[model samples]
Every structure is written in structure tokens, then in C-alpha cells.
Target: MTDNISAYKFDWPPITVEGYKKAENKVIMVFNLDVRTPAKVDHVIQYVVGRTVWCSLNSPVNVNILLSFDFRGQGIIVTKTQSLKSELLRLLNKANINNQVSIDFLI
Candidate 1:
């Protein structure tokens, strides 16, 4: 047993989400969205984050928020649950941005 331990090599732990997925038992859901304009991007992100926080606080299921936006009108939202995705879709509909917003998950 001592000889076997000596033959093994130790490695650094993973630091990113992808690393965590491989090293630990975890799953991350990613959703892709497109907003037609920079202003709309800002608005959509604000709405999503705000609602996610509010819902998480009031609801039993907490949403993990990880959002990335490009000035070029593309964005990606990373969440542990699909609730955030549903919220975003509802927001687009309520804001009358359905024509401008596109979800890759739905496409």
C-alpha cells in the first residue's frame, strides 16, 4: 500500500464551472439569448437578475445567477435551474420584445 501511494501523483483542483463538473458531481444549465440592441441587452439583464433574486428569496427553489452579455446583442445566462429561463421568456413577452429576442434553446 505504501509503494502504491508513492507511485501516485497529486494534481491541482479545478477552479472553473467546467472543472467542477468534471471533478465533482454537479450540473450547470446554460441558455443562449439574443437581444437586438445594446439598450435592450441592458434592460433584459437587469430584469432577469432582479426577478431571479426576488423569486429565489420568496420561492423554495433558489436560482444561481451567472450572466454574460456582449455589446453586440448576444448574451448567455448560466443557471442551476430552468426557472430563470422561463422568467426571461416571460419578460420578453411582457416587454413586447419577442420580435427582437431569440433563444437558442428554443431554436
Candidate 2:
């Protein structure tokens, strides 16, 4: 870390999804959960988390992903966007996420 590159030292996502949109790339999400059902959460995390990170790490360049999470700890509110295309949602058709826990994507 050097002071020569101040602007270069910035947060990923760049305050928006602009980079991903401009680069024409997709995003991957990684979350550490503290919910009621540990087994179910572990199943989803193991299956899908870090998938995009693995892809980007081995690629030429311009491949990127936003590493984000939703914390549903004690007395916390879950407000994941209704529009998010969750990996667990797509793959875990029979998981019954709604009933498994109180987690949800708010509209």
C-alpha cells in the first residue's frame, strides 16, 4: 500500500454496480449466516458461495464479482431485494427456504 496511487485504492463495487454493468459482467454473493438452520445455510453456502471468486481468480481479466452479504443475526431485519437472483433460490428448488427460517427478500 503506497500513497502514490490514492485513487487506485478504492472499494470494489465503486459505490454502485456501475463497473459490473460497464464491464458487462455478473456478480457472485458470499454470506456468513447466523440463522436458525445452520445445516441448510451451510448446504447453500458450500454449494454456491465463492463460485464467482474462483472464476475471477483463474481468468484473464475484466471478470469481476461483488462480494456482499446479508446479516440476519439476533434482532436484525432481512431485507434482501426481491429482484436478486439468488443462487440458492435457483438450485435449491426443494429446500423450502421460506419455512426453513425467517429469512426473506423484501420488496
Candidate 2 residue spans exceeding 4 A from truth? 1-20, 24-36, 58-62, 67-76, 79-107
For every candidate structure, what is the RMSD over all alpha carbons to the true structure, in angstroms? 19.0, 15.6
Give me the runs in candidate 1 sitting further than 4 Å from their true place. 1-34, 61-104
lDDT score, candidate 2: 0.36
Q: Which number leads on TM-score?
A: 1
lDDT of 2 by residue, 32-86 (tens): 4553454645443443323332434434355445544455444334433222235
- TM-scores, all candidates, are 0.30, 0.29
The weakest ten consecutive residues by lDDT in model 2 span 98-107
The RMSD (Cα, Å) of candidate 2 is: 15.6
Model 1 lDDT vs. the true structure?
0.36
Can you write out model 1's per-residue Cα lDDT over 1-107, one digit (the tens) per residue?
12122111223233122111333332232334455455555555554444333333332232233333332333433441244446555653544331322232432
